[model samples]
Target: MPRRGNRLLVVGLVGAAALTSAMAVAALATGAEPVAAGVVCPNPVDELPAIPAGARIQVERELSALDQQVAEANERLVSTAGQGGPNFAQNAILGPLRDKRAATLERIAIAIGREADRPEGLEQFATCALLGEGEQPAPTTTTTARETTSTTAAPEQEQDDVAARIACPDPTGALPAVPQAARAEVERELANLDRQVEEANERLVSTRGQGGPNFVDNAILGPLESKRAAALDRIEIAIGRVSDQRPGGLESFAECSLG
Candidate 1:
């Protein structure tokens, strides 16, 4: 009788192990496994104030974009796991994400301001974190890209504000009057030019401490000039479609300076 009882227990244990393995296999096959743990960002739009009816559509679009940004950032965090040093997550993924969010939030405020009072303190929503189990919530203090970079910046770099910032010529400043047909497209390209500058400045802030002396020019400003040049070409094409006189001297605006 004792031998039979031990045999039964052993069979039961084997059955349980097989069942667990089968379940795991089934989960994998069905793509039901949870994503690997990664950075989680907060949604600021959830806490947004009442949006005016005139601004509702643009506001909602920006809000949707905010969600998409977080999803992409989290995806990057998972894919680039163990790729960089301790500050890798911050400098590469989270910093750029925050800069993008800040820009988006500013757009949201501008959209709202066109119809109603502009929202204040949206900067609080910019920063994100990789929260571990039982970790404290992300800091709520409103830290701009400049302020965040300044804290860890070398003293000499901090002394010269120009070294820490970018100055790009405003492409729209010398533009000819855009025809009604080309106005919308021209405005969009102009906006892209502005976005290119904003991104370059943000990159400057995010990568302040790292890289060699020429890193800013090689990494940030050079690519910005290329992007601006492309945008300027698009603007000229947009104008050419609607007007006989395409804008000249746009190429001159492509190059940006560190200031």
Candidate 2:
């Protein structure tokens, strides 16, 4: 009876050891690590200025591209581990990544510039760092309710002082039937008019709280009206070139209002 008990205990010990080995293998196969290690890149988009609606699509695409660049760099870092010298990661991986990030950031800035003020010094966000073993990315700060209210109060007040966006009449809808010869030019001008409104609205949103009560009128709307008027004039000319009956009073639709 004692010998049988000892045999059972031996079998139990072996089973426990086998389970432990299986778990370790499973962890490796699943890429499950208690702590992550490799390169950690700062997300530049997190610091980006508010994107205007006109530029939102391009800006988002560039942001996604930046993420892809970081992922590829990290994969390279892991795959080439222990194969290169100490500076290999820096020269072969990190430096090129920084350049790619800088170029992508420039594209984002340009896209934003088409609608609102372009941000400066975006190249500063291009650098990345290698994280040692067991290290984690820095955590973002969390503000308490009281702190959040205090910090946001001024901005809210400023927003109240400014208009949210601008509204403009769509002159294209008011246009008469177009000739084939003038359709392309007229359509181009119509598109330009739409772009003008979009840019003005974006400017209004981005420049809230700046200037005086008449800021929207003196700055955004006035300039936008002038641009719209010019585009409308071109549309009228385009139609007149192909047809005797040209669209009249197009310039009247150029003036925009703030909401």
List the pairs of residues colliding in candidate 2: none
For model 1, residues 1-259, the per-residue Cα lDDT tens digits are 0111111000011122222322333233334543334455543432444455467567656766766677787778778987989999899988998999899889988988997788887777777666433343323322222235546787776777445578777777778888999999888998888888887787677555433343455346555666777789999999988889999888787766775
Q: Each prediction's Cα lDDT score?
A: 0.62, 0.62
Of candidate 1, the 10-residue stretch with the lowest lDDT total is: 5-14
Off by over 4 Å in 2: 1-34, 135-259
Across 1-259, the per-residue lDDT of candidate 2 in tens digits comes to 0111111000011122222322333233334553344555543432455456477567756766766776787789889989888899999998998899899889988997997789887787677666556543333221132234434667666575464567777776778899999988988888888888887777667544333334455346655766777789999999999899898988778767765
Off by over 4 Å in 1: 1-154, 161-163
Candidate 2: clashing residue pairs, number = 0
